[model samples]
Target: LEPLWLVGHTFAENTVGRLMERPPAVFATGASVGSVIEALREIVKQRMVTYVFVIEPAGRLVGVVAFRELVFADPNQTLDQIMLREPFSLRPQQPFVDAMREVVKRHYPVYPVCDDAGHLLGVVKGQTLFEQQAFEISAQAGSMVGVEKEERLATPWSRSFRFRHPWLLINLLTVFLAAAVVGFFESTINQLVVLATFLPVLAGQCGNLGAQSLAVTLRGMTLGELRGMSKLRLVGKEAWLGLLNGLVTGVVAGVGMYFASRGQTVADPVWLGAVTTAAMALCCALSGIAGATIPIVMRRMGADPATASGIFLSTITDISSMGVFLGLAALLLA
Candidate 1:
């Protein structure tokens, strides 16, 4: 082992080496096609076969021959002449992200894992590499919304309570902040009872918009697509989306509420309806920023971006939405 680094070094847990399966079919390059056929027979009898790796005397990978290629080849043909030379391989130390990129490009069913010096270690199934992480990526959606991925449908009640309650308390505190905003506009609510009617409607819109952005942001993070992307660009993109979406939805909501408020006794119904439109646009735009920014900041600080992001986003959206809605109503009507 003159170059001991390849043989002895430990890869980080998520690297291709840890997840790779034991080599299904492997033989020395010196073996004849007949001997390779016998080896395949024995190997297939013991386990499923995919590809046969051809290695050298020192166990360095030289080439590969797929099961179909070997089955169709003439038994008289030597492995040296038959095996495809210098096949694609992942080094044991390669990061999972790098391996995934390679897998995407090659679209191979199984890939060989090797050392830096090209000694074959094992092979990784494309499905095994992706399926495990697929669970992780999908589970992240629930985790963002304060649901623990590990908390199964059969999870004990006590465990469920323990998982959800802490964030629930944090959420409760945020609700009070929104409540306090309402308390600040107490006089206005008393004067114009109709403003209270659309309160839930406006809050719901902001909360939902924030959630939509949060889900998209988390998906980008999971795919490693956000790394090369500028943070400002992500923020800008969401902001513009929120603006356009908010403007259209807000106008509709405002008009709808205006009709609903016609019979209510208010000093200035028109001004109150105008406030709803303004608050909707403002809250939604701010929520989009909060949703996008929270996850990015969480990742930057080495925290799981998905951890309770929905709770935080909701809290922020609630406070801003209520504050703008109520503050505007007070200024206009009371």
Candidate 2:
């Protein structure tokens, strides 16, 4: 009789009988098929089994080699001698798409999950793995290679950002905004030629310092190793780091300006130095805050924190850096 034809209470009984025996009701195949039959009998002694499906060599699933078949065949005959060999067999480790194709073709209920070496590890049945993870991972596109996409999604969200695409878009937008900010400063840049010379050196150092703090914050969030108190501590550290970075970058830019424009005319550079220093410091501090907060905020909002984190961070750094620089210049230079 068909396993599905049973009614409610009997269905539970049949399922309980099938799943909880000394060993679960697993069908077996391959060279040691006879030994598997004995294993099933041992399970029957515990009132656990209703049947076993044994397969033949070459991994073809022969007819259902149930308890009755075992009883009739052999006090002594090896499974190879009595087992059916001409049967349906799926390649172990078949591509999931291919397995789905076969399922439609063959009308099979279960497909084995296996290693490339053809050793079976588990089974996929009735769209279970797909139903669980396909929505989240189908964006991965095309066939999964090596590790299964199902296994990949099983990892925590923080560690799974690399698999997603939103980060790349955010990065493009942020960088464009930063570039626009630099373009806005073109008039000031042309008037104060020395400032143009030092722009990169100033921004480069600030960018590095900002990036370092951002990286620390992101890693902490991703690892699930940060607590509320520790986050406050991180912010404090980044603040101090911003100040340190501002001092170093300012000094470098100021010294370079002092030397590069010794005979050239510009405004009182003491004023320029002060404002540049403050802007660098402010930008670094804000970058650190933006870096640390964006991911945490994303997580709180029930989104993937890491997915667009890098882009958001770049945007924060760019906008803040340009705004601070120009604001300070307008105040001190104009």
Candidate 3:
């Protein structure tokens, strides 16, 4: 703890403590700035404290309320009046990996940890957090790059890369699976080039719909706001949405295609029309499945559904959409 910087409330007052080797100092005034810097000087005189944190009146994270901000605020003002509101905070029970991510994203020297209701718990500085991660914990949490907790004063660039690559690899595998679906339908694609033209449009629309539902669900999950057994109810709602959207999109695309290409001697014009309608419906249905199932499954498996496996979802949508469209095309036009 000697080498580590401990703050009563802010960073500036502690310089004297480093020089004189003394006890830590605390904020004398409730004012946000003058008190914090004054407190910093005291910490330095005492030599035990290198930082100071300013807590708001109600213990909510108003701001880190740094010396810089304090300097700007009125010296006579209380912290409640001068303190910045809605500062980013962390949860005590959060995985260090998650903490690391927030720290890196915010580029903060320290992040405050709090309970669910916004009560202050402790502060984790960027350097110390990195140093505290043991080798085993780091390994079990996967690579320690972006969000993985780094417990050391300085984390190497290469070490950060280790954590990021695994997710990239997972993304690549999901891409390949999607590509495999396209490859499986090479014959159907060859027979009906026109169907291929609309394959993407149908699949893409459904994929988007499903993704919307997934996003709402996941957000609800994260906030602990999705109470009761309403998850299935929510999924059913999206399914109904898919049906409506599918009907509209299919009819519109089918009519547009038929009228736009009326000049061409299109084989099975009626069949083509029917195919478009069916493909849209199927695409929407499958999209809902991919959207709803993936997140639910990820959650059940104790994985972050928000790691955005959109690529995997897209892959599923593409394959399913293509398979349905081409299979129908073959039977109708063969």
Candidate 4:
């Protein structure tokens, strides 16, 4: 029941050993159902008992007997007669995150922790396992935007500043890349001022598309759902999604562009609209690919996938959207 913080352990750094509690109900292989029930009468007084573990003389976990099974079984039956053999277990030294992945689908109220030799060491409450993981998952959004996972609301201003300032500098550098793309198209913007009005629109839409892909990719990775799936396939799927979404949104944006520039005489409004439509679709597709790819690449490099992924994604989407939008305007209209 001790809080992880009190022991200077973060969720990510914890192992099953740190979270394990002494097993509440354990019996040798030959223990009878009546005797186990008798033992549980006193066991329940001190702590909760969900499952009865059957262990060998060497303390190796042999099987598990649920309480319901015990209640219905013949009182003379030995544990070996009713216990489920080769039950799943968690190793004490296994990382909490790994254990979480292993147990996510089991939904057991408690899990037995054992050594490499399968000797029963202790038990970990399912609630404790999930609570730690939930905390880690909750911090992912902050990590995506350059906030350190360790920075809590109670963190001092100075420490928060130190945690956040470096990423802001990196963000500034990326902003300049986007700015340079715009600067590269400076003449195009000057000639067609309407394009300037829609620059934010394109960037905003593509950035949003990229964020969607990023969020899904990170979630899949966290939940271990990405296993057995090809990373290339994931990126391709996101790109396809982006293309479809962009096509739909782009038409609306194109119509808006057509109306916004109707009063202007610099270029044909129809062609301008087409340029917007094309740029939006192309940039969104690219943004989706970038979004999915960035995190995968980061993970391959041994960096946390959620760490500043949003910042990197924003830079990519901004550059692609603006560069494509203005480049298209210049090519087709100018």
Candidate 5:
């Protein structure tokens, strides 16, 4: 007899179970070759079959045999003699993404679905799983910048505005905070005046660098590389990368600032250059740490690292870049 599920509930929506169809041919462990061939003739007309599954007397899945094996076998042979005892199969409860991952390298036309005890449930096509995965991944493209998970591509423009504006407004608040940092160093800005001109240049560069780090961290998480890796080690690696990159970029930005300052009417070009250089290096290094740390912290706090990480990192980069640039000027050049 078929599993009870096949008669009543069938497959569940948005799961591998839902994607599965009743196998074209399923047999008990004791089934004879002649019986399987007769069943195959009826099934082959309805669907293609590359393999046939063999199950135990108690309805537990036991093995599989290529369709060719059945045609060539002696009519008296039992399915047990011809079947490959250990066959790959999916569980009825597996999500589409995990199922797709499992079947990535498999080139089978069909696969059996089973329960925890290996009872044969149904069969699913490999192509259906791949199609669902592609659709799911493409739908999530907007998730990186704080888009709501429920938002769809065909969502009304009004709904899209509602979904988007909240984050934009939050970003505006962080921009104000960055402005407040510069406001704190007004005395330094007043003394040189030229320092005000380079503020955006400094902040924008660090923000871009921080965004790069955030992208890489999110990618690692998505690929499941962070699963068994040490969080501290990941943090340490980002910090070192930040420092080394800052040193190189800081030297270049310093040279450019030094030359740029020569054309300005500043009282102390060398001191101004030194301050900008020091601020660049300091802000960039901290921004890297911020980029790496924010996502990890979000993950630990049970928030999605991808959705909110950009917002946290933006706040860090803007505040750190401006704060360091102006604070260094106040301490050195003011």
Candidate 6:
């Protein structure tokens, strides 16, 4: 058995090499099972053993033998006869995230780390890999709102401020854009005061729709589910979904607008309701398209998709929803 050494490193710094430990049980392929058992007896005293690695005389991994297999094997039989040949192994230099995606379904207790030539280096426990990945997943939520992945509850106020302020500034700039859109339609809003009342309703609904799309896209990206799929297909699918969802929700909102504007004199209530329906459906569909496209574009541009994604998403939804709603009112009622 060998000692387990813990190395402190961030998730980005982790690789199979840094996480692996010396295997407690290893034997040359030609070693007899009786000799392997004898060796295991001594190895078990110092560390836990699960799978016994079998390698060539030159230290290249050739097979793996489970403890259960060894317990029932003939003492005189060589390891090659019972060991599973060409067992799965992770490369020492592979990123921990990449390795995780490969082994997620296998759920092996331990994975052997190897070099390009299949020389055994060490082994990593499944628990360690999952723990690291869990931290990364948790950090992703904060990152979406412009929080740094490295920030913690105990992070210094100054550092936290620095990490957060820039994103807020960016968010403010986007908010101003949305504001500008509303201001551009100020005359229309004044003419139809009811439109002003429903501005928040349109923005809120579209924002929620966009957020739902963003969440699904980010989850897919994190799980490597987006690999090999056409980006155009994904975006198109989201847009279609958005359109369907918008049609349903828009009908409800349009009914609400009809009642709210019944006494208004500037425009016919029925026309206002129709305008709300059209704008709601169009803006919601656009929100979905923006939600799916933003992350994909950011990733292609070498930026973290989750970094301040919410801020950007809010900006798009606000501008589009306001612009479309007010424009429709001006066109139909003014």
Q: Best by TM-score, which number?
A: 6
**How do all models score by TM-score?**
0.79, 0.51, 0.54, 0.82, 0.81, 0.85
lDDT of 2: 0.55
Q: What clash pairs does model 4 have?
A: none
Give stretches of model 3 more than 4 Å off.
Answer: 1-172, 260-267
Q: What stretches of model 2 exceed 4 Å from their correct place?
A: 1-170, 228-230
Cα lDDT for residue 274, model 4?
85
Query: What lDDT score goes with residue 252 in model 1?
Result: 85
Cα distance off (Å), candidate 6, residue 223: 4.6
Two-way lDDT contest, 2 vs 4, winner: 4
Residues 153-193 of candidate 4 have per-residue lDDT tens digits of 99999999999999999999999999999999989888878
* Model 5 regions more than 4 Å off: 6-15, 105-108, 136-141, 148-156, 227-230, 259-267, 300-303
Model 6 lDDT on a 0 to 1 scale = 0.87
Q: Which of the predicted structures, 3 or 5, would earn the higher lDDT when compared with the native? A: 5
Q: What does candidate 5's lDDT look like per residue over 13-83, in tens digits? A: 56788787777677787889988898889889988887878887788889998878887899999999999
lDDT (10s digit) by residue, model 1, range 1-334: 1112233346687788777677767777767788888867777888877888888878788999986777788888888788999999998878776677667757778898887778787788888867756656767867876777677789999999999888788878878888888888888889877778888888899899988888889888776789788999899888888877788888988887788778877645666667788899888899888989999999889888999888888889888888888888877764
Q: Sort all candidates by lDDT, best to worst.
A: 4, 6, 1, 5, 3, 2
lDDT of each: 0.80, 0.55, 0.60, 0.89, 0.78, 0.87
The regions of model 4 sitting more than 4 angstroms off are 1-12, 32-35, 72-78, 150-160, 222-225, 229-234, 259-269, 299-303, 332-334
Q: Can you write out model 2's per-residue Cα lDDT over 206-268, one digit (the tens) per residue? A: 666766776676666533467555666777778877877777777666666556656645566
Root-mean-square deviation of Cα positions for candidate 3 versus the true structure, in angstroms: 10.9
User: How badly does each model clash, as a count of residue pairs?
Assistant: 0, 0, 30, 0, 0, 0
120-180 per-residue lDDT for model 3 (tens digits): 5556565655554343243322321124434233767687667566666776776677667
Error at 73, model 6, angstroms: 2.1
